[model samples]
Target: MKKGFRFLLKTIMWFMVITFAFVVLFKWVPVPVTPLMVIRYFEQDSEKRTFWKHDWESIDNISKNLQLAVICSEDQNFLNHNGFDIEAIEKAFEYNKKGKRVRGGSTISQQTAKNVFLWPQRSWLRKGLETYFTFLIEVIWSKERIMEVYLNSIEMGKGVYGAEAAAQYWFKKPAARLTQYEAAAIAAVLPSPQRYKASPASPYIQGRKAWIVKQMHFYGPFSYDKK
Candidate 1:
């Protein structure tokens, strides 16, 4: 029992050292690839399944409209929360208990951590690791850095990641040049990017885009300053 306990403790210590180095290293340098990208490459329909468009744009390079749109749609309290949104978590839990339209309350921070470090799984272990990484980034990275990484690293669509790539694919423009409406449309498809089209205007996407535009206005102007 003592030997097993010692081994487990050593493993955890090594994990912490490695993860801390990784998070700090990524704070300045762009992440070249993520676990999700690797996972998607393997879980493909045919050979050369992954067709990635990962242009790592700096936070200032991406449109503020896209940032606002995502904040409005995904996690409004991103600037306020340390890692998790308590009210959203409570609401999601309540909704989940009802067994009706089940919901998730993962903050952008959480999603960033999960997307970069962990595999896409609904397991308790993944959640636990996600919590750890989320806390690490929240503590180590400034709000702007977190927002920068999130905007540049998330899966915008099938084999498509980052704002730069998404903007180019959907609007044939650079991410920095995206208009407010275009940004909102991208945000609208975020809930299920692979399932929804951001262009040629599906009614569902249009409706969600309209709602997101209102939310962008509702949330009002904000900045990603350090808290």
Candidate 2:
């Protein structure tokens, strides 16, 4: 029993060291691929119907409006939070308990952690692992680095990942050149990108885009350098 405990301790220690090193390495390096990208590629449907769109443009290559728009739409307090938004998480918990509707309280940091290191599914194990990885990145990576990875890694449409890909496919331009409204339009579809079009004006997207623009005006020019 003592030998078994020793083995477990050693194994866990090795995992922490390895994962910590991996996370730190990514702080300076671009992530070539992520777990979700791999899963999306292998989903039999992806080959038959959906073609993946992804290009890793640095955060500096993406527009400032887009940065503000996503922050406004996804996590209003993204710059302020550590890895989790405690108030939002608490609200989500209470909202779920009432069974009124289902809502997610995942902060941008948590979503980045999930997209980068974890798989597509919700389980206690996944959530536990997400929390662990989120804390690690928050400690090791800057807020700009966190946003850079999130914007460049998240799924924008059926198989699209990152700002450059989304801009090219939707707006026929580079991410650096997207207009404020164009950026907001892209941000608006993020909650259900597959369901909503960022162009050609779906009524749902039109309404959300307007709202996101208002939010951007309120959020007012957040460059990640602030953090």
Cα-based lDDT at residue 188, candidate 2? 89
TM-score versus the correct structure, for each prediction: 0.96, 0.94
lDDT of 2 by residue, 1-227 (tens): 99999999999999899999989999999888898878877874644855578899888899988888888889999998888999999999999999887889999999999999999699999999999999999999999999899889888877889999999989999999999899999998888877888988689888989999999888786655565
* Residue pairs in clash, model 2: none
Q: Write the per-residue lDDT of candidate 1 for residues 122-203, one digit (tens) a residue.
A: 8999999999999999999888888899888888888788999999999999999999899999888887877887886699
Query: What's the lDDT for candidate 1?
Result: 0.90
Q: Which ten residues in a row have the lowest lDDT in candidate 2?
A: 43-52
Candidate 1 similarity to native, TM-score: 0.96
**lDDT for each of the candidates?**
0.90, 0.89
Clashes of each: 0, 0
Model 1 regions lying over 4 Å from their true place: none
Q: If candidate 2 were superposed on the true structure by all CA atoms, what would the RMSD be?
A: 1.7
Name the lDDT value of residue 144 in candidate 1: 88
| Predicted structure with the largest TM-score when compared to the true one | 1
